[model samples]
Target: MSATRPPMTAVGADRLRDELEYLKRVKRPEIVAAVAEARAHGDLKENAEYHAAREMHGFNEGRINELEAALSNSEIIDTERLAVAPRIVFGAIVDLVDLDSEAEVTYQIVGDLEADIKKNLIAVSSPIARALIGKNEGDEFDFVAPNGTKTYEIKGVRYK
Candidate 1:
């Protein structure tokens, strides 16, 4: 059987690379030092420092492995290489207005791995983003949010 992995956008790849660099350059050494210092403290059975350090080491190593695997298998898509259009696609920045509340919000449509709600980056698979797909300016779409169904009007779509 073959394994399938999610495609990562360029921004997601960069974030992953930054995390990997931090793990390798900073976290790994810090964990190693902590483990060594804990080991020097003596009695492994009752050494609180040793146990804590060991736990931290395990977590750090696990994360390192996971990041490495993701990076290795990642399919990075450059946003600049994508064709620009009115309809939503990966890397499209869309401006939306809430039809009910008349509130305005902008979101960048991105890959799953790079989705950050705080930054107004929505994953392509998200309900709102999914509804926005294939829609152009002046179009309206309804999304089922946790509270209830809400409608949004597409104000604009841009590549940048």
Candidate 2:
């Protein structure tokens, strides 16, 4: 059987591609040069510089592999091109309001790798995103978070 592809937003896929490119074109070469320079300094076992460079190289390679795998097994979805009215799905941007605080927030429901709370991009697996899923505009729902349960109102939903 073929490997199942994980869902990914177009933006998330592009970010991963950019990161993979940077690691391969910039970081990989920089680490290789550092390792070479360190190797020129004599003994291998006791050389701290050499060991550190090797460790960093390993990390860089690991990240490259990880990005490659993620990209390979990903099903990228472009929300902007979607003809249907955005109804809180993967790649849709949702606007929400906190019922208690009356504060407003916007979040883009994205893939696991693209989840960055700082950027207001939430993973589909996250509690808030799960709660928001399948919800229509102006819909109210209760979400049970780690802190406690909170009520949220769906102010709007946009595909783009």
Top candidate, metric TM-score: 2
Count of residue pairs whose backbone atoms collide, per candidate: 0, 0
For residues 1-160, could you state the per-residue lDDT of candidate 2 as single tens digits?
8876778999889999999999999999999999999999999999999999999999999999999999988899988887554467778788889999999999998999889999999988888888888888888999887888889999888887
Clashes by residue pair, model 1: none
State which candidate has the highest lDDT: 2
Badly placed stretches (over 4 Å) of model 1 are 1-5
- Residue-level lDDT tens digits of model 1 in 1-160: 9876666778788898899899989998998999899999888999999999999989988988987887778677777777766777778889999999999999988877678999998888888887888888888888898999999999998875
In candidate 2 the C-alpha lDDT for residue 63 amounts to 97
Query: For candidate 1, which ten residues in a row score worst on lDDT?
Result: 79-88
Error of 2 at 13 (Å): 0.9
